[model samples]
Structures are given as C-alpha cells and as structure tokens.
Target chain A: MKSKIVSKEIHLKKRPAGFVTEDDFELVEVEIPEPKREGEFSVRNIWMSVDPWMRIYMVKGSRIMPPVELNKALSGGCIGQVIESKSDNFKVGECVKANFGWREYWAAHDADSSAKNITKVDPKIAPLEYFLGLLGITGITAYVGLFKIGELREGQDTVFVSSAAGGVGSVACQIAKIKGCHVVGSCGSDEKVRWLLDELKVDYAFNYRKLGESNISSELKRACPDGIDLYFDNVGGKHLEAAIDNMNIFGRIVLCGTTSQYNDNNNTSTTSGNVNDPSTPTLSSGPSNLSLAVSHRLRLQGFIWSDHNDILNEFNASMSKWINEGRIKWKESIFEGLENAPKAFVSLFKGESLGRMLVKLGPYTATSL
Target chain B: MKSKIVSKEIHLKKRPAGFVTEDDFELVEVEIPEPKREGEFSVRNIWMSVDPWMRIYMVKGSRIMPPVELNKALSGGCIGQVIESKSDNFKVGECVKANFGWREYWAAHDADSSAKNITKVDPKIAPLEYFLGLLGITGITAYVGLFKIGELREGQDTVFVSSAAGGVGSVACQIAKIKGCHVVGSCGSDEKVRWLLDELKVDYAFNYRKLGESNISSELKRACPDGIDLYFDNVGGKHLEAAIDNMNIFGRIVLCGTTSQYNDNNNTSTTSGNVNDPSTPTLSSGPSNLSLAVSHRLRLQGFIWSDHNDILNEFNASMSKWINEGRIKWKESIFEGLENAPKAFVSLFKGESLGRMLVKLGPYTATSL
Candidate 1:
C-alpha cells in the first residue's frame, strides 16, 4: 500500500465556560484522504484568522453563525494552496481563500458549483496575509461600519471608536481621519493608544484600562468634550453605555462586536441556571440610561459584514488607491505555528494581541505542483 | 379699578418620587395679568391635554422641554377662544391654539410676533378638541414616529405598539393597520385591549397586565409568531427588553416613551441617596438583551415630534383626508374641569385613562368678542 499523508487539525473538545482556555480544544492528526471523485481538489492551508467573532460561533444557538461542533475540526476563514486538483475551474498550485480553517489540509471538490465559498487571490496586489487583514473582511468591515452605518460625514461628524488598535478599529480610525472628522479612540493598553495617536494620527486615543479609577463615562466625556456624533463600537459592555450617555442628538452607533460579553456568560445556554434568581444569570452589561436613546434622538444599530457585500466593489476601488498612496496602514500579530492558534485567539480576550491576529501554517512561496 | 380676572392654575408642589400623586401638584387662584404689549390678546382657555411626556418633563433638568417652574402655572399644549386681540394675525372671536396651559384664562399681546405661538383654529374642519388628540401634537407624533422614524412599510412590517390605547399609541395602531401591516398592541387593561381589537381592528391586542407573570418576552413571542419588524415603544423597561429579544433582522424600534420606568426611581433626584452603595441608584429599566441589537442588526432610535416639523403640511393633508373618510377614529378620557387636570395627568401613570387624556376647561363656543 502507498504511504498515506497525515494532516494536523484542531478540534473543539469542550465548550468554554466564561474565559476560554487550551483545555477547550484538542489537537489531532488525521489521515489526509485523497479526493474520491472527479472535480475534487486537495489544499494545503497556510494562513488562518483568529477573530473575536469566532467566540460568538462557539455558542450553541448563536444567531450570527452555526456553532463549532463538539469534537469536530473547527471551521473558519482560511487561505491555502491547492496541491491536487481534478477540476477545470481550480488547477493544481492555484492559491485560494475559503472557509476551511484550523486545519493543515482539506480535500474537496473544486468544481465551481461546490466552491461557492472559494475566491482566487492576487499576491502581487499585496502580501497574502495583508489580504486577510487590510484588503479582505477586516478592512471592508471598517469601511461599511464607519461610512455606511455610522453615516460619518467629512468635517461634520465627530467619531469615537472602541478597540481602536484592533484590526477593524485601526482601519476605522484611519478612515475617519482621512474623512477629516475628529476621531477619538479607546484601547486597553498605552502602547495601542500610542499606535493610534502617533501612527494612525487619531485626534485622541486613550488607554481605557488605565482610566485612573474614574468611570469610563467621565473619561469619555473628557476625551469627547463636544460630545460624540458617531460611535463605532467593538467592545460592547461599558463602551456601549458610555457611548449612549455621550452621544449628541441624532447620533448613530454602529454595533460591531460585544467582545467583553462573550466570555462573561456562564455557559452556552446564556440563561442563569437558577431560574428563580434573576441576579445569578450573567446579564450582559447594557446602558442604564437606554431611555436616553429616546431623549437624545439617537440611533443605535447592529450590523454584520455579510449584509453589506454589495459595497465590495466600491470598497476595493477606494481601498486600493488609499493603499497605493500609503494613506492606509495596518499591523499584524502573527503566530508562527498552527498549534498556537488557540493561544492567539485567547490573547484577544486578554488584550495582548494588537491589530489582526493570525496563525501562519507555513511560509508563503510560489504555488508548486 | 375693574375687578381682576381670577385664573385657577396648577403648579408643581413637589417633584414626584416614583408615582405622581395629588401631593406633587397644587391648585392656586392667581390674578390674571394683562399682556403688556400692544399686540397682545386675552383668551379664555377651553381645553388642554395631559400626556405621558409630561412625566418626562417633571424630571429636573429635563432635556425635552423646560421643567415646569415650582409655584408657577404648568405649561403645555392648550386650545382656547381669543376673547380679545390687538393684532391682525389673531382676531377676537377667532378660536386659536397656544401653549398657555393648566390655567383657566390668560391675557397676552397678540402682535404677530408675540402671537407666533398661537394658531387660529377652524372648527368647521374638525371638532376643536380633536386637534389636541388626533390633529395636534399627539396625532402628528404618531404620523412622524411610524412613517418617518420606524419606516413602516405597508404589508411588509410586523409592528408592536405598547400603551396602544393612549393618544399616540391609538393613532399609531390605526395608522399601521391603515398602512396594511400586521399590528399587535399591548395595553394595561382588558377594556383597552378590547377597544384595540374590536374597535381599531388590530390583528392582535393583549392586556399586558394579564400576562400571568410569564415574562413579556413570552407574551410578545406568542402574539408575534413571525417576529416583530418594527416596535413603536411607548413603555420602556420590560417592553424594550421583550422587543429587543423578539426583533427580526433589520428591525427598527421607535423609542417613544418609558412610562414603566418613570416611577421606578427612589426619589425625584433619581440618584440613590446611599452614596456608599452603587446598586441603589434608581437606574431606569433597560434591555439586558441589548447586545442582541448588534447580533440581529436592529436599530433602536429615540425621536421627538418637534424635530420633525418639516412633515406638518404633509401630515395635515393626509390626516385630514383620513379623518374625513372616517378611516381614523379616536376616543378621549375627558376630565370635566381644570381642577381635575392633575388627576388626569396622574391617571396616565395609573393606567386609569384609555385613549387621549384631556382636561376640558369649558364648552366649545364660537369665538366671541
């Protein structure tokens, strides 16, 4: 018998309760089965994203995406090279991006009909990983959120962005600055604050973690003295409450992520186990003065990137020019090995990773058959 | 000297703690003063409105309208006959609408500038008090919040209105039904529920008080099996939370009122006096499921009718046609005398009055010189 190829993969072993740890996942090595049918291909994964949204997927009944099956290989956005193909659409050695993540290799039909999720990438346009960050979902998210949802106007709106040093926030900060709006950003660390203020040229950046024991509301008030006209929220909890309090009349809030609330829930079934005791269930943080939303004539809306796919062409045209002119900048926190992917994801919650965090399965090279 | 005209007025005696009571207001007989300007007119007030928004106005430093001054006549929307006029714009015997409220009689300069707040009424078009309920700010509020803010589409949206028996709510229910939407309404009493279902012909109407201790979410879900697309919120707290939980993707919530939370605060200041304990503050009830707003792409917006004066002419045209066609119907909970005005206002919080609550100062008469 011919020797079989083996692929390393990560699987969800247990559901995370509160904070995620390595124990929640398991690493396994499985035989890389050859394509059993015509029009199939085998791909060697190289780069994968570790995003905050993945935590949302872990919940059993998340409205956004399906949950990660227990004891199954985790699935997410991945970029890889096809090593073998039996289809006319995908030739061997072609690089493509798809939703087959947290694994070393994948084998599936590469027929155009079955490859609805796959897209061919151009490396000469930018580095392969930059496609995952500045040119792909992350960048498009910032564009749609800031300009489309927040209705940010050049010189007219004053914007406040939470998680300012993260992938979407960094791009949002730059976009607002480019639009000539006064931008204020809040991050967990001083270094991230410096990156936003000094590198991104954000009008104001503050370390929300070190707010000197004062309430986030007071800190935000000081930072946005004139009051915020637009708010792009990533870390929900206190950030949302403070935004509601400080928003100007007819302000708009683009709800992106609730990173703080994800791990705080006790379990997949978000309700507190004791039904009689309302206090025990982990209630997500909300604005105590939500009534202000009415008084201030504020608009708070939640949005996901998929709903705005129609803007892709316009986003690409503007972003490509901005990138070529160096008007846009991005940073990455790369974990070298696939084995460290779980750790990379956990660091997001800990506020250790800066910008977009990704796991590199292997080095980039010309596609080889 | 001519005997001075005695005007009985209602004044704020004490700021309400939770539920407004008779103690919060005092009736005072004051000598009516003549308008000092040459263009001023004296009028005998006939009818005035009592609305849910008055609760919001009672809070100190209310951002909506200026707070009613202590020991001074409370001001609100009022209709009266111009007993005297000194200007071309307003003539004696021309019934007009003005903001001089909570008093029996007033003397004012009717110079075009001084009379800017007053508008001559044409009773030949509709009954005079209908202006206060169906044609005035109340009806205009329903028109703006539904079509303008909530963006209600005929046959496309599923709408839920809280306090659906009140002025704005009753109008909103009829408007949504007229627009060809699936309308579900919640009121405090079975009688109000019957009126909404039997009289207004709403698709669903339920007495929220009879929900049998099952959370509002359960009751709402049962009523709106297809999920709610638009929520015209008149009662905040549990209503908001239930609405958030049941809202569909791209749903819109018109944050109109928070009557439920009006009395939850411990005192008039609203701050829990216990400085050492943080939880004691009378925090207005807010949606704990607010994070769902981000997940479902929901838009919760607060709006005031004043912000949308641009729609007045259109509103008058459409609403007049609707009323003339008998496509719109309204009911009034009338307090016979100005002395009963405070009770009328308090009845709103008590859920005692159905439809638009109004204080009838005197019989409608043709303007007389």
Candidate 2:
C-alpha cells in the first residue's frame, strides 16, 4: 500500500471580523510527522464537516465558548483510518471518527480508544457522508434542541426554525414532522424554500432575505395562525424577535446559534430591529420584544451541543433507524481537495453552500474493503 | 346578627395618570339589594389587602394583561364573613377569602366556588388581619414567586428580593431567612431597610431611593460576591435591569411584578427610555440588558398567583409553623379603617406603609372566642 504522506492542512490565520474572509485561514503542507516513542496512533483524514458554529469561534470576542486562537489549524470531528497504532485503543487498518480536523493526516498520542466506528457507507441506507452530516452532530443538534430544550409535544404546537434549509434545519423539519407539528422555516433562498416544503415536507418555508421583517413576522403569523409553540433558533437577530412576537403562551425558544450577528470587526451594530422604531422601522433588535416573553409566559434557553452528549446514543439509534426506513435524507455541498476548505468555511456565512457544507479530504481508502 | 346589606361600587373612574388623586375616583353611594334567589351568597367585608398588582390594573393601556376598563371599580381580594347564603358552597357565619372587592359587602350569584375558602385564623397564633396580609394573597405571592419561580434552594444560593420590606418582600425575606439562604432586600426607606435586616433577618437591606442602580446591583454583588443566584423581581424597570446585570450563571429571575413601570401609563416611552439601553448599549431602542437571561443560561419565568389555593396553603402552613417556632417575624403598617383604604392604597406607590399593608375594614364581630 502506498502511504500518502498527506499533510495539506488549514490553520486559523486570524479571528474573523463579522464575515470571515480568505485572510482568516492559512492552507499549509508538511510531511506526515514521525510516530512518537511508544504508544501513539496514526490516522489518514478522508472527510471534514463545515458547521455554522465554527463561525462563532472565529470571532474576536465570542460569548459562547471562546475565541479560536490565531495561527493554529482549527479542529472538529473528522473521519479517518488508523494506519499505524501502538496503543491498546486502536489496531492497524481500522477506520474511526475523531475530532481532529482540516488536515490530510493526524497522529494522536495515546488514542482515546473510544473513537466511534465508521468505515464504508451503507449505500442501501444512506451515503457514507451522511454519517458526518445530518446523522451526526448536525442531526443530533436538531434532535436535542427540539426535543430537550424546546420540549416539543406532539400535535400540540408549531415550530419556527431559523435557517430552515441548512443541515440542522432540514433534519429538524423532518423530526418535527414526525412529531406531527406544523414546521415553518426561514432560509435565504427560494431553492431552500422549495426543498424544505417539497422534500423535507416542512409545512411552510420562507426566504428571510426577500421578505421584510414585518412581512416575515406577519407571514409567520399567517402560516402558523395558532402561533409558534416552539422556536428552534439557529440564526438569531430578527428571527428571534419574530419568534418572540408570534409565540404562544408557554412557548419555548432554543438559542442554538446567531449566524446573522457573526460579523465581529465592524461593531457597526448588533440589533434585532424594533417595530416601534419610527426612523428605521425594519431592523428591530432581536430582544426588542422580549418583554412579550413575560406576558406570554415564554421560556428562552441557550444550549451547547456538547452539553447534550448523553442524548447522542439515543439520537444515533433513532436517526439511524430513520435513515434505514428512508424517512430521512440529506445532501451536502461538497468541496473537493484540502485547499478549498477555507472557501467552504467562508461560503457558510454568505449562504453560498447548498446543504451541509463539507470538505472531502481525500479518496476513500481500501482499509474497510 | 345584623347582616350587612349588599352595596354598589363605582368602577374604573378616569384612568389615573401618574399619581391617582381623589379626582380620579368617583364614589357613587348606591342601594343594597336583597339576597338573590338561588346559588347565591352575600359577604360583608372584614379586612382587605392592597397590592402592587393593583397598580398594574390601574395602568391605562398595559401590553401584557389587559388593563381594567375606564370607569370600572378596580377589583382585588378581601377577607370577609358570609352574612347571607343561598349557595351550597357557602353558609352564613363562615369567614372566607375572595377576589370580590371594592364594595363593603357583596352578593354573588354562581360565584367562583373553587376560589372561595373558609380558613379561620388561629387567634392563638396571630391577629385576624394576618388572614388578609402575610397569611393571605401577599403571603402566597411571595411564596410562589420565591419558592416556585425563584426555585429558592436553601443554603445553595442567595436571593435578592425587590421591595423587600413590602407585603410580599417582608414575607419573602423571612422565608429565605428560614430556609438558610442569604437574602438581600430593596425597600424605599431607611426604616424599612432597618426593619428588613433587624426585624425580618434580611442579610442585607438597602433603600433603593437612597442608592443608584449601580450601587444597588454592586451592593447585592458585594454582599453576595458569588452573585445573586435568584432575583425575586417586584419593581421591573431599572431595578430589573440592575438585578439582571449582577446575576450569576444559571440564575433564576422571578418576574413577580413591574411596579415601577406600572404607573407609567405605558411602558412604551414618549421617550420609552430606549428599551435597549441596558442590554445593547450601542443600539438606541434595543431592549434592556434583559437578554442576559439567554447569555448567562438564566431561567426567568413570570407568573401571576394562579394557585391562590395551593401555594397559599403551603405558604400559610410553612409560615405559621415558622412564626410559632420564632424563626420569623413581620411588621404590619395597619391603616385604621375602611375610610382610610384609599389613602393606604395610594400610599403603596409612595412607599409610606411598611411591612404588611392592610385596611382594617371592620372589627371582627364574629371572631370565635
């Protein structure tokens, strides 16, 4: 077997300002590092997932978690093969998942031993890449946020999902549908809207950019006349305010991410515009109508995906079953080659990617076969 | 027994603006009708409790719960004896608590029987007026807000009670004290603060009028450097904002009342004081720093005293037991007679009364010997 000394890696160049740019990352190459003295493990990267929360980490002064350091390769869950192993945790030629990312290859000292098993894609069920997308952290995020924080009760309410056609939104729509709830999603494009309503079978989907805030709020009200009972919030700002305004009594708002307010350097404004603004009526600040929460008896909670680790096993079990039943389907906007990873990460903020934006690190190896 | 006759009351007079003066009230001395035919009862007022929520009722156009209609007599709770009864739920000579108020006596047909309760105050334990104040709705409001919404876990965290020496505050301080939690209270006078610390055993007590918002927040923070774990909010405007700023992570804010904003006619400002002033300093109208609820993983829930029945039972049982044990004491700023009820009610806004504010409607003619 030809061992490709893969070392093409993407490293953090600078913390991003609001929207991330090419300057925010550095793509570098190096010879695969020599193995450690004793118990070390080597792996080859095959796939890496690009997530919206990564944008939050790129900010100058982040509130959720901490700001990513400048000049270090950012990391996340990546699928790879155990090429060489000296630890009890791994054996040669085994494929696994670990949170070491944006690199062509890695060698971990004292492998965690608990790296999840993932080799070949079950074509009869879902594509191999689906394991890294909706069926993975993205899918589990939607599941936990909706089920645990939102506390969705079947047939009892409507769910307002911001960024409704993105990875988590798509899966959340399906989960909500299974729970027999009315699902209304807000995304950036007509295609997302179509895919959401037609394929994901969300009850309603609207292009947030095209619709004004008032119209958006009213459209949500019109779509879910009974009023939103659960808000699975991904993109904050206006979406949050709209959800708060149209929430039913005892509604729950899950604050997962705020993609809209990610541009850090500008510091021009961080507002979810208010309707009461006489001059600039449209850009109401997100928390403008929050007092409505007290009257409506609303519950708004923020959550980190890591906090819900216990639900992962249950989520994997249920989501895998859904995949097998052909009830859940996912697609990825794939960027081939390690060099294009930065472009994919930046494209996330601009809504350039069609689905779960991902980077294919290399061709699948024959270890599993 | 000379049965008190049914009386008429003037409803909402001119909607009071700012301070409610005598001009804002219209007293129409109307005739008392004979006892109704069926499922009816008449109650002669014995004692009545005035509350800050009554200020909410007097607001011109409240965005939360609807304001009382103009020219309608404001309604609240009172303790009374059944002078005449035709209902299966009530009998003559029994004293009960009720929401039916304003008039000296009442004749109800098919009244809310579930809401009516006949609990004879233990004369050996406390005064009969105690049945209207600390042992009544004021007591329950404090109990539920602090115990239920605030989730006061004893010795686990500190509690900050706004209006700490008032009806609810007085009891809340005592309860938190009994539960072994450090308690900080905000009242309007030095005497009230002295009483809260000296008499009610509040760990720290400050007169809000004597200190700025920063001083109040920092004082609480200085007193409980771990930061306030539970904020039992009574005054909503600046105090709410200040308490929110000083809250610890996962803090609980019980939105019991927003009395400061209640007298404003509308919380919406002619200036509306930039709703976002506290939270988003850059934005002009962004909602106040209340979004700390989401940022700090805080849980804030506002509730009216819905369980006027259950929480009251829990509160009274707990309170009586604590009082008998000498673990708690209270102050009562008793107004002399029914004629002084209006002055006492107005004095609530002025912070003139200390401890449990009560209007001794009449001598308890039927107190059991």
Q: Quick one: best lDDT, which candidate?
A: 1
Q: What is the lDDT of residue A354 in candidate 1?
A: 58
Per-prediction TM-score, please? 0.86, 0.84
Q: What is the C-alpha RMSD of each candidate to the true structure, in Å?
A: 5.8, 5.5
TM-score (0 to 1) of chain B for each candidate: 0.85, 0.81
Comparing to the true complex, what docking class would candidate 1 get? acceptable
Predicted complex 1: DockQ: 0.45
What is the Cα-based TM-score of model 2?
A: 0.84
lDDT of 1 by residue, A1-369 (tens): 434569999998887777778888899999887765788878888899877656656666365556888888988778888777777777777778888889989877756534357877776677787767788888888899987789898988889987777778889889999999999987766887788888999988887668731377887788889899999887666777788878898899987643423433324243221111111112344666776776688888888777887898899888888898899888778887889988877765654445677899986668543
Query: CA lDDT of B38 in candidate 1?
Result: 65
Q: Each model's C-alpha lDDT? A: 0.75, 0.66
List model 1 lDDT by residue over B1-369, tens digit each.
Answer: 445678899998877777678789999998876544667777788999876546556665354446667788888778888765566666777787888889998876655433357777778778888888688877887899998999998988999987777677889999999999999987766887888999999999887667742377888898899899999887666777788889998899987743323332223343221111111112344666766776688888888787898998899888888999998988877888998999887765554445667789987766334
The deviation in Å at residue A218 for candidate 2 is 3.1
Q: Alpha-carbon error at A125 in model 1, in Å?
A: 2.0
